[model samples]
Target: MIDVGLLLTMIVAVGVPSLVARWWPLTTFGEPVGFLDVAIWPAMVGLGVGRLVAVALDGPSSLGSLSDLLIIRSGVEFWPGVAAAMLAAAWSAHRSGVASFDRLADLVPLALIGYAGYEATCLVRDGCYGPETSLGIRPPGTSTTMLPVGILAAIAVVVGAVVLHRQLGRRASWAVVMGGLTVVAGVRSLAAIWLPHIGDGLTRQHWSSIAVLLATVPALTAGVLGGHPATRERQLLDR
Candidate 1:
């Protein structure tokens, strides 16, 4: 039987943007229907790429045939899927004449909240987990040590979204949330440090997290300086 929890995770992750956008007050950057439009193709691409990357990373032992490789539902990585999807969505949005950055700005809060939903779903489904240790309280239902990171990740996102919502709606302020996520990545890495599964070496995400932190400095700085003045009119009245 198909895993109901996993199915729910996918649905919530994809449907979140639409749910959030449905009641949004007027804006120049996004249409109520635009989130799904921006998301659909990229989601397809992300799933394909994420599954392929998993196949490659897992090595030849797992794959008996090309047909097995085509099956994406069994394995997927969030970072690869998200990265690929974001790029695809960005390109697609640009091609479709949507204001890319502005839409992305609009997406930050929704994405953060959406991701929290993903983290919550992970509690029920086997998903991104951290090291085994007593440092953090175990998730209520699962014995997994990873829930702390998910909790922290959710907290960081919510905090960033709250912070951003108070801003004058500068597109650059969205980077502040990016920076917050970068910080969460570091927190996850630190949590993994005590994990037996990870060992002594820094994982790929650790390196990527550092890279994000490095990028975040400038992005946050630029946000503070006022980003893309052309977007000034799109601002939702400074609060």
Candidate 2:
């Protein structure tokens, strides 16, 4: 039987971001860019690439058949998906004649909120259980009391989204993008420590997060030193 709940979850994962990105008033160099028009490209490409990456990481046994591979209700790796989506967004922005970095910065808030929405779905999904603890809720069909990490993560990211949104009113600079990403990566690294099955010491994700955190510093500096205007909207707003 088709898992309707999972299907809905997937829809929200893709739809919420796309809708937000679409309606989002993304401006670059004092001009409006129709990110709303190209939102679906990134969403679809990210989902496809993320699913493929997950299957590859899981090995051949997880592949099963071509039909099975097409089933995307489960088995997605987060970082890979995010990377693919970013690449897609960059390409889309370029094709639309908008500078990529500004658009990406504008996209950060939507990404955070979208992640929160995805995590909300995890509250009911079969997996994403956190480490067992007294301060946790036992998900359906599971005896162990697992932390409500999904909801907590959702709340956390929602807060982040609000902060970033307020920081960037109608336009975005590369500095904002790098800073937001750094914060988010750090948060993810910290949160992953409490995930079930995480072993002692730094894992690949931790290393990746650290690398991202470090890399952003120079990028942020460059962005700031370059004297890029945070918002370039003319005093007279577009009608």
Model number with the top lDDT: 2
Give the Å shift of residue 42 in candidate 1.
Answer: 2.0
The residue-by-residue lDDT of candidate 1 on 1-239, one tens digit each, is: 77787789878776765676675432534444555655678778878778777777776665667888876666665567767866776676587687665555555556666666676566666554555566655655566654356656656666765565545254453664564455445545555554335457776656665665676667677766776655665585553
Model 2 TM-score, 2 decimals? 0.74
lDDT of each: 0.62, 0.71
**Tens-digit lDDT track of model 2 for 1-239:** 87877877767765776666555555553565443345567877888888888788776676767876788865666667778888998887787688787778777877776777778897657655778888778877888988877778778877777766666743336677876776667667767777655567786666777777788778766755655243333423442
Error of 2 at 223 (Å): 5.8
Q: Estimated TM-score per prediction?
A: 0.71, 0.74
Candidate 1 clash pair list = none
RMSD of each: 5.3, 5.6
Off by over 4 Å in 2: 14-24, 28-37, 60-65, 131-135, 169-172, 198-207, 217-239
